[model samples]
Target chain A: MPIIVNLDVMLARRKTASKDLAAAIGITAQNLSILKTGRARAIRFSTLAAICRELNCQPGDLLEYVSGPEPEAAEGGE
Target chain B: MDKIQRLSSRLRVLFLAGMVSVPVLHAVGWAFFERIMATPPLNFSSIFGLSWGEPPFMAGPATLAMKLLGFCSSMLPGAAAMYGFACLAGLFGRFGKGEMFSAATVRLLRRLGWAVLVAQGMQVLHGSLASLILTMGNPPGRHVVTIGLDSATLAETVTGVVIILASWVMDEARKLKEEQELVI
Candidate 1:
């Protein structure tokens, strides 16, 4: 399964550096990098809202869900 | 390990040794000096300078003893304060988070640092006064009588001050560094 973070697109659309985005969101640059790389454990709604407001994008523009193996295929024996 | 963690480990070892050694020393003294040879029975007042004597002045019955008792009672708080702070040291030493601890743990280390500083000051004052009274106030050449006070007081006061300051400064520096990291 691939859960995508389109943070790089959002950043490019707003012409903002990741460092500036991190400063705006009150998080470390390293943490912003983590989010941008889709390695964050989870995102807070407030953080997502801050990012959207700062980058002028909808939530869907920043995040996406991709298809994965079907449940039946995962279960094997079932 | 970080400095605080190292110091804490050292202190735990010292406290453990102290807990064992104190009772053993007392028991050994009792066996050798008091019970075994029985050399004229040790005078408790001579050892501690705590006289239960009668008072002069106002032709009263016994006021000096009261003053002595009050003095001893007053000293107890200093000792108690040291013990309380020592308990904090032990508690933190056992369970404290080091430099990698969370913000809450860092706050706890800060408070423990303050406690260490306060306790060191009190113990220094207490030990200095007590040693001065026991050593200089006693007769000039009483070697056996003044044997323990000077050594014990100097050792405790100096070590207490050093450990207290060392632990506090290390923790404070770490906290400031962490705060600065947050800023950057």
Candidate 2:
């Protein structure tokens, strides 16, 4: 995915634990881990809003768009 | 969900019974072939829609060999039915465990579909073979060869194709569910 999730960086900057953020955002710890590791297919707007509210940050601060070949395409080319 | 599980459990048991009974019933029918033909009400000729011809009264090697061959050929359809029933039992077992959209369930459903088609095809083949075997004891030039197709067989073929298509659609649904679960 070209779109990267910077949830770990935001959590660290806000001095928030992943478990506490998950509980506050009304999601499971595994789901929060999925978001942090960029394994999620897509995040719901409500969940994004909840995460932003919990960390006191903007959506842009949590998500970053980097230009590069897709991981699958890169693997296939090799 | 609980209701689905309960219903699935009951259906699983029913399919398991069918899986066990199919072959046993075929075996019993073959073992008492002459007696059943002698009895009007219990005659398989009416059930299978084929003339069983005159049963051999005296024991002969040729007649016994033909009967044995018929019995073995008859087991083809029974075995196919048993496989279909077993697949249904496994599919319902998964449903009972609340894995309704799992890949294993879809695979079992697909297998059941193929089994149904194979069973129907085997039935057609068995019918012709059985007719020849039953008439093998007749005088020369008096032998009978029969091939039959009824509406029931056609309906079963359509049902099998529909099941295979439904399993394909279920596979797509399973993929979508997996993707949805991955979304936070």
Candidate 3:
């Protein structure tokens, strides 16, 4: 959940519509929407590669890792 | 999957028919069985298929009471069987709709488990009561009461536990499926 999809930012920068990107990447617009909204459970490497190729961006540009709050120490921790 | 759906549809019809018929059959049979089956002289041996090793302990009032009690004892568990079957029929209907991992399916399966388990318990009670009544007038030390568990009861117990376990598994699967759907 901490790994966020930044697909929308790259799509906007490239001036490419989601429908066009979906067509180019050989995926449904709905599936692309899921990826764009960060609702996808996982992205296949092949699909990620295709999206990057279509968007003229690297994988890092389409994904962002945000650190969550630190967990409390365990009861027995030193 | 299509074939499974088709078969489930057919099974749904059969189960529904059975559900409808059980109560109707019991009603008709209960209503007419006494009149149609009770012949003169009323040979208890032929009627019950038991050799008592002596004459039946039938008197005027006792015989009537015995007959009525037997009818109720037999029919009580018969009604329970109908209820159990109805739950099974409802479960089949859900399956027919292809709602395999639904809350409704889980409810029906749980109901079926309870129905079967309770019905089997009632059947055992009925058997014990019948045995007791039939041996009521036996001489001292000659009477016997049987509250034994047999193969049928064992099978029903296993079936009820399996059905309940399956329902629990389905409930877990449904939750997982919902979470997976939310992922997208």
Q: Highest TM-score: which candidate?
A: 2
lDDT of 3 by residue, B57-109 (tens): 43222344555565566555566667777777777777777778778888888
Tell me the native contact fraction for each prediction: 0.00, 0.90, 0.19
lDDT digits (tens) for residues A1-78 of candidate 3 = 677899999988999999999999888899889888877766778888998898888989988889985334431111
Off by over 4 Å in 2: A69-78, B38-63
- CAPRI class of candidate 3: incorrect
* Residue-level lDDT tens digits of model 1 in B4-112: 6777777766665654553344334323422322343453222222222111112222234433442453344334444545555555565434534444444444554
Off by over 4 Å in 3: A69-78, B34-87, B125-149, B171-184
Local lDDT at A12 for model 1: 87
Chain A of model 3, TM-score against the native? 0.85
The iRMS of the candidates, in order, is 12.9, 6.5, 9.5
Q: Candidate 1 has which clashing residue pairs, if any?
A: none
Error of 1 at B45 (Å): 28
How close is chain B to the truth by TM-score, in each candidate?
0.35, 0.86, 0.70
**lDDT score of residue B32 within candidate 3:** 47
Candidate that would win on lDDT: 2
